[model samples]
Target: MPAKSVANAKGHSAGFMNFIREQGVVGLAVGLAIGTAAGDTVKQLVGAFIDPLVQLIVGSQAGLKAAEFTLKVGDREGVFAWGAFVSSLITLLAVAFVVYAIVHLMKLDKLDKSKDK
Candidate 1:
């Protein structure tokens, strides 16, 4: 390889590293990964435990996820899956609560760099 090309590549590499550090890209990436895992965990918990309880209360023979209402109008039929929506909403709330709890308990919010005036 030419010396000039090698130097340019090194400069680009250094610039990229500096960008990552200055922008907190690594921390953002780690947070995203952990958040995804946490969301999945909460979904599983809701699906396995909370969903069944909801199903029992809703009295859906097909389970909460499959529970829906069918509306017939003339020759048209519309199915409204309210149960699925409720289940998803529950999952979202659970994930948000879990993330909030973790951040609060661990004081992770304090680690952020203060904004410049």
Candidate 2:
């Protein structure tokens, strides 16, 4: 390759790497991966432990996922599965809490650069 071509390639690579660093693309990707794993873990924790406790508190044999009521209107019945909604809500809350705890406990939030005024 010509010297000029080699210089241009080097410049392009440097620029690309600079863009990645300045935009925090790698950090964003890492955070996304960690968040996904944390969400899955939190869901399992909620399902295995918190869900059973909720079931005991609510007195539901099948747990929160089976806590639902049926609505009857003029021979028409509609099954409203509110228990599943509660289960999902609990999972969401648990995931958010876990993420918050991880970020704060590790002080990851402080790594972000302050924006220029």
Candidate 3:
């Protein structure tokens, strides 16, 4: 390879590394991984406990995760599965609560205030 081409390539690589560091990509990646795991854990928690209680109210044998209402319009039929939507909403709420608890417990929210000074 030409010397000039090699130098340019090296400079580009170094710039990319600097961008990653300055943008906090490593911390974002770690937070993403932890958030994914925490979401799954919260979903499981909801499925295990909350779903059954909701099922009793919805009265679906398949439970809240499978609840749906059927709709028909002039012989055309479709089911509006609000149950699944509700289930997803539950998952989102649970994940938010779990994340909030973790952030509160770890005092991670204080970091923002410190940075403001």
Clashes (backbone N, CA, C under 3 Å), per candidate, total 0, 0, 0
Superior by lDDT: candidate 2 or candidate 3: 2
lDDT of 2 by residue, 1-117 (tens): 999999999999999999999998998999999879877887787678766766677767356688789999998999999988977786677667766877799999988867773
Q: Pick the candidate with the highest TM-score.
A: 3
Candidate 3 clashing pairs, residues 3+ apart or interchain: none
Clashing pairs in 2: none
Scored by lDDT, model 1 comes in at 0.80
What tens digits encode model 1's per-residue C-alpha lDDT throughout 31-108? 999879977876687678765666677766356668799999999999999978876776577557766877799999
For candidate 3, report its TM-score: 0.65
- C-alpha lDDT score of every prediction, in listed order: 0.80, 0.81, 0.79
Cα RMSD (angstroms) for every candidate in the order listed: 3.4, 4.0, 3.2
Question: Could you estimate the TM-score for every candidate?
Answer: 0.63, 0.59, 0.65
Tens digits of per-residue lDDT, candidate 3, 53-117, equal 66676676356667789889998999888878887776577567767887899998877664546
| Segments of candidate 2 deviating more than 4 angstroms | 1-27, 38-61
Sequence-dependent TM-score of model 1 = 0.63
